[model samples]
Target: MSERVVNPTGRGFLLLDSHPAGCFATVARMRAEAGGDAAGPGKGPVALVVGSSAGYGLAATIVGLARHGIRGVGIGFERPAGRRTATAGWYRTIATASMVAEAGGDFTFVNGDAFAEATKAEVLDLIAERFGGVDHLVYSVAAPRRTDPATGVTHQSVIKPLGAAHRTRSMEFDADGTAALREVIAEPASEAEAEATVRVMGGDDWALWIGALAERGLVNDGFRTVALSYIGSALTAAIYRDGSIGAAKAHLEATAAGLTDRLAPWSGQAFTSVNGVAVTQASTAIPGLALYVGLLRAVLGDRMQSPVEQSVQLWEQLTGARPLDLDEQGRIRLDRWELDPAVQAAVTERWEAVTSATIGEHADVEWFRTQFRSLYGFDVPDVDYTEPVETDLPWPT
Candidate 1:
């Protein structure tokens, strides 16, 4: 192993490297902020979290261990190969595991493709030997493509509208590191592409996991499962809420009832949790979301909630520590703050008035940039980037 200074690489929203110290610091900070005070060694609930390496999934794992004291198993697809560093999610999950162990809690991690049947079997066997049964299941997988285990077919998800072309104002970074707004026109997806997106992003895998758990008798009464989703404002409807992603989300949401019905035998339940807007690896890739998030932050200021905050609330609802807040379709709505009419109105005003020249005035571009950098384990507070650090840190025990 060699030591070297690692700076943030990649342009725009995509990142190429992850910093170990920065990722550890982020997990520590989030755990502290999201109710780590309650963490202790005890017999808490058991949770199996799919996609538990980053974003809301990472937050859920942190909250479960640090706040709710849950014995947890996390599944993620990440690489920590020869020369290059592991993905940010890998570091984050390792950090979480380290923190949980320090707190005298149980947290295991499996790094592999969550959609694969062998992965499912390994997870199930581990659960059987370690936790006996899982009390909660958190599904938050986000990927560009998923290979069907049965059919051996890979379906790639695309971010385009279903029926009509859409034009939206988005942001791009300049060579000098200045961000500028640009017009992005997205053409409608073909029928095959739309279906493929659904196949990749929808609830099929979630349902499969549940079925596997049930087949192994790994669910008991009062068991709960949650899948994370987002429903943005009308400002991004064409590219988000009404786009092919939205179709996949709709399928995910609709799958909840079926999952609940399937779990009825054990008095278990499943629901989609509509989470708040936050900077995550997935959000950075969506068209227009960066700009919309910046404006939303500028308008809402401290009222906006991060993924950890929303996840803490989700844990409260799931564990019956707080009353469930469901929408008309019986799904949890943790995005109430983002969807507040006043907040949306203010964001809309900023979205209409803002331009490249006035972006700094109307949008929290700095905040957006900071959050985005934090996702890849950069720009974190008190990190010593000047020092030569090991890129390939061992996964925490």
Candidate 2:
């Protein structure tokens, strides 16, 4: 059996044997969130999910299939397993497919670049063949680069602040397996870089997907489409809420407004849901958000929610179990719990005093490390990591 080692930088692969336990743990959490007994045939709506392999996208897909009994079609970009190690998203996709099948839910997954028009066309074709039409579409894609099909120009998303360079503290693992605080200085994004970031991370592709699906007559009446966004606290606003990514998010919100008007003819509705901060691959890439998340965990503890829990809440609200509360700008407020007055007050107090010397005392750094490893199917209690396991698992064709 081969043992996996986590990269100290927290952005690389870990060698592992199998991931059955992590996969099951994800399903168990989803079932629990839905109040148990998520077993049933696909008798509800048919939903299409983009970037449906990790984080919130994966959680939403699980909820749509297990809780809502939707016939699920997932689209993702993941590399195949190689000799030394497999990408985490690839393993996650395999696990998601297995769990969906176990629940007797119809699941189809397409592994490819979701930004391309070809991939969109293929997904529409699959939906037409299998389910005839879709009632819900979830857009949760997070990529660094996108290519324009029309002009063959590629755009890359930037992670820098808008103005001057920003400095923040982030967590990193040491060679001897200890959490250490590191300083991360992110440079300001150039005008071109900011523009490219918007082009890639904005809602252009999302709008295209809806348009293509509608053109093919694959959108049901009263259909709904949702795109996820984030609005963090003032502490990280410079690098996150008001930065290049934030500009892209603004564009996404604008696109939602446009899509709502565009889809009015079909009686469809579009929404932008501002979800809470959670441990995701995409979130980890942000400059200083991890420190804030660690502090948030320390403050909120058990009160804090996972992506699966948040997704369940979103499903309930959208399905009319709860009232849909929108902000002045017509955006859903799923970040309410994260940004609770009490929670933010505590976090703000700690943020003011937190430093390299005090981070360990003031933040849940261990919890942050555990959650990050869990995303890659490591540090799971149920699985015996020493046992030999197959790396190559069959995915849906």
Candidate 3:
């Protein structure tokens, strides 16, 4: 009798680990192609990553070290771990920071808020005193709740569509890809709501952090910066593009434009990566996304690019390759892959077949859901979930 074991990394580890590496590689290439020697930039960079605990930002930190071959400092302010639940990204950071140090690179983690002036000051002081100044800054913050530093009012962003409530069927893969009836989702947000969403997501925090650092003499000329964003697909348009999140991204794109202008004198530019969708801790919560993931999986091939792969692709764009193909809004448009004629043809075809007139458990959807469930450290075939999961994640200092 033999027992099967599913490794933890098998779930979503690759997306987390390789994502930043791919982006950094692209950044390095961009630096090289710009006819600018990549390494002359201020003894490399003391890299500062906002939202550095998980998702795209953490990947950026890891990628900065692994792919870019640049070494300096890393800083962020993620809340320390709490009772019972451990953030997956934090663990990955530990492992990644250890890898960076072993290779003789500097990595530092300061958990808190990117928007907080105090936190920003702390990051700058750390960089100025110990590592000189940061040569690059990566803004990847994605918080849903923000208290206006001035107003003191707490705000929460919703994951709803931007237009009138629309009825759509998405998958609840946790129970197999049953075409669960997604009720007509909420309507488009008001201008005030949209602006608030943007305030939390837009480039204000990023610009502020960069400005503070530069003012403190931590920025050298030719520094580069980037932020993460998404445009999803037509299927997710209401919930994503026109939705509250979409509104925020719109503001984010504008934020980049402003940052680009502000940093022009330093020969620095801020670019936004219209990153593709993936099974991330963040992406899962977006309304109508589970179905998008399932269909996207069937469409992108069994090789649906993991977040790490997507990040690599992102890196390629960031570092002087081709600015990612942009939309009318002048924002990166990687989400176009979701709506490509060929890719859409495939997902729609499978969706129709699986969710046809005959309604029962879809074996294909079931398999996908199982894999997805495994992503959250549940329902894996290889490892016993009952066994306490042990890891050796090295928290970056």
User: What is candidate 1's local distance difference test score?
Assistant: 0.89
What's the true lDDT of residue 58 in model 1?
Answer: 88
Local error of candidate 3 at 73, Å?
4.4
Provide the overall lDDT of each model, using Cα atoms, as 2-decimal numbers.
Answer: 0.89, 0.81, 0.60
TM-score of 2: 0.93
Tens-place lDDT digits, model 1, residues 29-69: 99888875654675688899999889999888888887788
- What are the TM-scores, per candidate, against the unseen true structure? 0.98, 0.93, 0.78
Which predicted model would earn the best TM-score? 1
Cα lDDT, model 1, residue 167: 90
**What is the clash tally of candidate 3?**
26
Poorly placed runs, candidate 2 (over 4 Å) = 1-39
Score residue 268 of candidate 3 by CA lDDT.
Answer: 80
Alpha-carbon lDDT of model 2: 0.81
lDDT of candidate 3 at residue 381, scale 0 to 100? 39
Superposed by TM-score, candidate 3 places the C-alpha of residue 202 at a distance from the truth, in angstroms, of 2.0
Better of 1 and 3 by TM-score: 1
Worst 10 residues of 3 by lDDT: 12-21
Of 2 and 3, which scores higher on lDDT?
2
lDDT of 3 by residue, 182-268 (tens): 434566676677777777877667777877876777777777777888876777778888788888887777788788787887888
Which segments of candidate 1 are over 4 A away from where they belong? none
